[model samples]
Target: MRNATIKDVAKHSGVSLKTVSRVINREPSVRTETRERVERSIAALHYQPDPSARSLRSTHSYAIGLVYDNPNAHYVISMQEGVLAACRERGFGLQIHPCDSSAEGLAEEIIRVSRSARLAGLVLAPPMSEQPALIACLKAADIPLVRILAASEDPADGSTCVYVNDRRAAYAVTEHLIQLGHTRIAFLWGDPHHGSSSERFMGYADALKAYGVPLNRKLVLSGQYSFDDGFRRARKLLAVKEAPTAIFGSNDEIAAGVLAAARSTGLDVPWDLSIAGFEDNPFSKQAWPALTTARQSTSEIGQHAALRLMDLLRQNRDGHTDSSVANESFVPELVVRGSTAPPRSASPRAEAPAGDTDSID
Candidate 1:
């Protein structure tokens, strides 16, 4: 038996090849009735479009590339899920490339990958997305790229971007702790390479300032966006002579570490000490007592980035004069869980309150 082709689908539906191509590509110009008829023929034949054949027929490629240098596996997976959703819907393929952003040949490596893959467009994830050198290289290569970045740091010209407002989300998390009567809150920071760390720190600082809480330099500790880093930094913080009443991890991984550190020291979470985290990743919920954190939809952000990249590719292919695509931005909401609460007492050494098991949501 022979395989069915686009020609067979077109013939079965009594339509021209161009109409079949338009319908398959989901172009909006196709009439509704004609589209339904073609779809029916396609279902009857179990026909699938060949990406290689389409690439050969068109000037542009059908593959999109996602480039990132993030350390969090959960974050990477979520972003991939979102990107795949968009790619599948648009009849496009996805190629994921993880690289070192600090390498001297980073830009050259990305350019080589883009050329080799013959990608239609690219989605850049932070901190790689924030690199000026890489952006320059992509622009010089004349490649269509959309970046996912911190909302506060997006370019002024409104270039294609899916922005995550880490600063605002961080502020909300910090304010949540403050409202719980936590005056001495500590911040566990992520790697300096990531722009999100700085944005989140600014939000934490802003919340404290707004509430007239003094910013204690000793309470801020530098760490990576990982469980091990969080655990190590939190252990040291817990050992301090005047430990903070509340701890805020730059990400959920760090917050989970904080939870473990508190447990090791026989301290009760949200009773002896309160803890919070950002990015509402799985680590937040899997903890013994769920972590109070900011809920940023990483998957949605990735999907938007992919969609924006496709839009840019379409505009370029159609020779449209628009210089840039619209930007999508989101401020993560605060999800109060069991991890944070008011200090047991005004003093840091106050013992855990008796039989206190109250949790928020």
Candidate 2:
């Protein structure tokens, strides 16, 4: 069967092509009676507007862009799904753009991308979203966007952004371990460049402090956001003369690495050493003993950001309301799994270190 088009809807409704366009776009100027008539005809004809075609025919494109810079494939995919979902709801198309956040002239590059794509607006994900300088530059150019950032609260005043409370979630993860009678907890860090790594670290620190557990700088290790990095760090931490009773990987990948390291070194999880992580990735959950971690709804946050951007675009196009950015906040929920438990009654140290982590300085 031939697919119905905008022209077919206009002809069926006895309306001009322009009128049909206005109706499809949901313009405020369209009278209710005419809109209903056009809608009925659209339904009867089973007509669907080709966003790509309409975009080419007009200055305002029917598609938006999703910009991100991250190494984790799972994280990237979740965010893309969320943004794509919102685009479908508004009858818009999506363009995924992955770029290096550290590149020179980044602000200019993004503005150029939006212009070249003829995008209606943009939805930005970290670490680009966390860059204040880049954000300022884009805002100066008046590009419509919604940003997703790792922050405990609004990172700016009079700005529109979606913030994920990584700090809070990290705190909860650490607290869970602490409550399990594990005072000698080791903290692992992902990339120090990303704000989320620091936010998660702060939460871990807060939990230790609140519970009167003395901070042991030697127990803190730094590494990238990867399984290999986690495994390497875990090996080093475990080899120490006096290792942590519990280990907290900043993310699930790291936590999974820690789990592997523990088993390889003949350490019994939850009994000899407790291990926990953040970001409940699927693989982490499917591990031999499911990981206890915080559930970060990456897709939901991305979806919400795109939805807000859509609203911003509408308000701007209609000139009906202020287009000031809305600052939104979200927090991850804690999910306790099989990986954590109370510490052992006695400290059974791993083999003395071949490479010392006695002092992390």
Q: Whose lDDT is greatest here? A: 1
The list of candidate 2 runs beyond 4 A from truth reads 7-48, 346-361
Candidate 2: the clashing residue pairs are 160-325, 160-326
Instruction: State the lDDT of candidate 2 residue by residue for 1-361, as single tens digits.
Output: 9998888888899999999988877666889999999999988987767779988888777889999988999999999999988877566899999998999988999999998888888898888887889888988988888888888888775557899998889888887887777778999999887889999988888777766678898999988999899999999999999988899998899999999999999998878888888878886778878989989989999999988887777778778566775778999889998888778774332332343311221
RMSD of each: 6.0, 6.6
In model 2, how large is the Cα lDDT of residue 17?
93
Model 2 worst lDDT run, 10 consecutive residues: 352-361
> lDDT tens string, model 1, 1-361?
7878999999999999999988876666899999999999998998867667788888879889999888899999999999998887666889999999999989888889999988888999999888887888888888889999886545565458888888878887887888778887999999998989988998888777776678898999998998889889889989989998899999999999999999999999989899999989999999979999999999999998998888788767767876577787899999999998778755322332343311111
